[model samples]
Target: MNLSRPLDSAGGTDDSLGGSLAFGVVKSERQRVGVLAVLIVLLIAALLWSVFGPVVMQPELREKVRASLPFGIGMLTVMFLYECTSFGWLTQLIRKGYEPVYWVRVVNAVIEPLFFTAVLAFLIVFVGPLNGMAGPAPYIYFPYLALSALSLSLRLSLVSGITAAIGFNVAAFFAVHGLEATPSTAVLVSFPHYGMKGILIVLTGLAAGYVGHRLRKQLGESLKVARERDRAVSIFGQHVSPSVADRLLHQSVELTGEERQVCVMFVDIRDFSNLAAAKLPGEIVEYLNQLFGPMIQVVNDHGGIVNKFLGDGFMAVFGAPSEDLKLARNAVACAREILSSTDRLVAAGEIPPTRLGIGLHVGVAITGNVGSEQRKEYTVIGDTVNVAARIEQATKQFRAQLLVSDAVAEQCGPDVAGAVDLGLVELKGQPKPVHLYQLV
Candidate 1:
């Protein structure tokens, strides 16, 4: 089925295709966001380790490492918990809402300083292997730094702010100790400062675990969103078509500026004027609405867009909005369905035997959105539209219910065996004559 035609032309809705596409986009974006975050963090961590070396222990090295580890560990833990909470929050928000602003984020921000100070301060007081701390000064530095990190994290998303704070703290620590600079030519390397060394090792391992946890949490959340989007789109696609609903959900519009071959079909009820004259206006409208239901089903079943209802007639198109090789086949199928349904209606005495004329033609057309900013419709506009209409008019002269241009017949291949040739005729207002075929 080909569905890339104008919706208003036939007066129908397309939700199936649109919905599927929408869900796909949402899923992809969510996954990409998670993957990108992980990659960026990995890069920053690699750079930090490279510039600062594996471990620092002496008094000089201890001070430098203390400053840097907080930022790294602080960021890692904050982002980890944020992602875990964010997933739950987002899912709840979408389904209903169970209060996203909880204590998790607040606690995450507060914990960085508490954890850093506890570990570093305890090491300074008990072990005293590195340079001796000046009373609470060393301990105060850790909390002060942690609070600063927490404050920075509040402005950005928990993940982004944490990462930035970590990066900033690390750079400042390394800069203050001249770790980023070349080794001092005059001073020789000192012995390992056991307390500083133990603290540094502990912080790095914890930070790594924290970062890994965040990565896992983010990936899990992304996967959930993808699955949900897919499930929703699938269910929604069943109601309308996937195509239209997907577009609406994802908020995407295709504007491909390329001319392409298309199959156009136009149908009109015979003696519509007489029917309207005999019946009340409301009755006529009600009857037309009922008729439109079946017609729309037929058209959409064959992957066509119901463009518009012009008075007593309706227009449909295939191979545009998007294109496919089965455009003409779909149109032909639609015509057959219409004929069969109308015949049943006539036999049941619901209305007079419908004298329908379906025009089919294949040609190049400018297929896209048409109309001004306030009122735009997706449709094709070109000579092909005119030719299809004329072929419709020719159905009367040919004594056939369906008239197709030679262009359409060629595309139909063996299925066109039952069609009869209609000699080339000069259509009204046409510069060139067109060859037509009648489907018996």
Candidate 2:
């Protein structure tokens, strides 16, 4: 049996990665809200100081305060409501029903920077052209610029940053023209001076973009790893040990498509059909669970993985998902240990008395991820696998508990020392006879 993915009602595969990405998006949105809240608090503190405290009591400013304060407060309120509501809507969309829309998120990224532009315009209208351009209003862009990095997109950050700079310079241009005399010669809004500030803002955005780009790359890799891990757990069940999973993903061992030299082992319960017929289905399942659980652990400890469980037994592999120089040897060692473990379990009365037949062979085989776009499986399939299964069946004919092909006998290290040569045995459905050795 192969691992298969469950299809959704819409005929789509589960979008685990997309769900993870949405989680990241939610975090960024929350951060943006924090940034905006901080800005509002700072603005409120500045207004309170100017209106009550002695920070700014300039004769020219006192009369203009009342007019400017209402518009400033209004702008802040609108910004707060817009962002909080948008954030709420996005959070609900992700948490409740639909997948996040890309264009909607991108639009939000574009709109956030525009708030600073509105603030700049407000400042120009309240304070004089030159004074407003030089005031803290322009500095508000800094926090907003930094917030863009949360998108983990360089292009979005750069576009948002550079666009704000141009908008600022444009507002400055129109305001400077408000002066009737020497407007062109005004040094504060001069192209050279103001252009340098604009350049600095653009540069800061570029840096933030680079940071976001790096973060995006790292997050993608982390999500991919998490998806693979969840997939493995889904296929193998909770009883499958981590050691078995680790073998498939240890350093330099990727489960990509390729041909590799592998040791294939087929294990089966001898006379399982006869034994199962006497018991209820539930009892059969319980017996199999009790018997196979520890045997699978033995396979894991010996650097082999039970690829998939058959009704009565399992097919295990060595050196496919992970490279093992001792693959043939490990497969041989693992098979012997399983035989010992089975006898112990039966004697302990943990499971009904039973017998197992195991066959091992080492040869080149095609091993990798296979299946449809929605369903994928990492498995071994080749002549070596076929021969190994055939050998397991031959065990009853030869009256042996375990058998290994000539290739396994040669490559399986010291385990071959006492292997009894069974000579050429013609396996069923095979064109030629196979040389076999009995280990038990």
Candidate 3:
């Protein structure tokens, strides 16, 4: 017997997650560029103010500011160039792929620390004492550490912290020496003070690194779970409806075997063997595709799952994964639609004219995962399923397009319109006879 499996969905969850990550990376890069642009604008404004402000309000500071102008311009130029290069690098990285590589994180860790170091060096050697603004130089470490912590890499964050601390101490030493009339006493006293500041920088780096590491670990775990859930949904969706697949992934119901009242449907193409013998393999497959495609959609639309495809046919089930009170009605409606669709296809010359026999029965059946440990299939098994198949076979003898057991017709209520009672007929392998109905 041929078993028709549910058709696979068009896209998988991996594609979805991949697209999301790509968009996120592009957004991050754009944000970085925007921030850099803003910083460059602010720096240009500051440089303009420094040059012209002293001339207007602090005439005594005018010469000093002019003396520091060249150094300020040089520092700003370096920063601008670095930011532009960093932006270019980000664009290139995104163009290649959005995966977060170790080297990229390392580069990110080093760049900010190096830039701040350059700024500190310039402040100590030129901008600070020359302009009489040296007090705030030591306080720059806080923001540097704060920004570094955002990298989400413990090693990189720690590296940035240590580099900033060393740079700060080096800048402080140079500033102290430049101010000292006598170097010996000044150097000794400055060493201990800068040494304490270095210790604080290290502690801050450690604390930030620890927190970042923990957060990154948690975020990774959450992402892993989401990916697994997406994958499960994709795979399970092939066997069941998307809504049912989602519920399965979320553990709303157990997949272990259980007996449930379900309506089983079997549809077989009549004279399929004769058609196959006359046509090429490709033509046969094309013909089947044209036939099965619409039939599957009809089943899906009426809340029936096309559980399996037998070589020349397929089996559908209703109310297995979840109970459906209207399953019998839905199955009957689905069968009607399938017959109409096949007729349309044949008339349109898309598929050769063919006859189909469908059988539906409603009863309690064992439904769930069935197979080996390595492989399993979620399906229904029991007399209801077998009886449905037998009823389908009976269609050939009776020369009827559709047949349903008394149980199915009863469950269908008023939905089985134009159905003619076939009276009591003994189905194969059954001790008692079953009343069948043929849909007009």
Regions of candidate 1 where Cα sits further than 4 Å from its true position: 1-113, 125-260, 297-303, 341-353, 365-382, 422-434
Q: Estimated TM-score per prediction?
A: 0.51, 0.53, 0.60
How do these models rank on lDDT, best leading?
2, 3, 1
Off by over 4 Å in 3: 1-150, 153-191, 199-256
Put down candidate 3 lDDT per residue, 184-265, tens digits, no spaces: 5554345566778888987787777787677656665665678788788878776665655765455424457889999999
Candidate 2 C-alpha lDDT tens digits along 208-262: 8898889877887897888887787656544434544444444343446678889
**Residue 289 lDDT, candidate 3, scale 0-100:** 84
lDDT of 2: 0.76
The worst-scoring run of ten residues by lDDT in candidate 3 lies at 2-11
lDDT for each residue of candidate 1 in 1-440, tens digit (9 for 90 to 100): 32122322232322333333323322332343344335335534753563366653466545554554555455555554544554444444334312223244345434543443343443343334232232222332332232232122222134333433443343223323432223652121122232353354335334543544454455546656775787777786554435544543564354444588889898988778877888898988877777777888887778877776788888888876666788987888788788888888878887665688888988898866555555445567899999888888777776688888888888888778988888797777678889988886
Largest TM-score belongs to which candidate? Answer: 3
Which of the two, 2 or 3, has more TM-score? 3
Q: How much lDDT does candidate 3 score?
A: 0.72
Q: How much lDDT does each candidate structure score?
A: 0.57, 0.76, 0.72
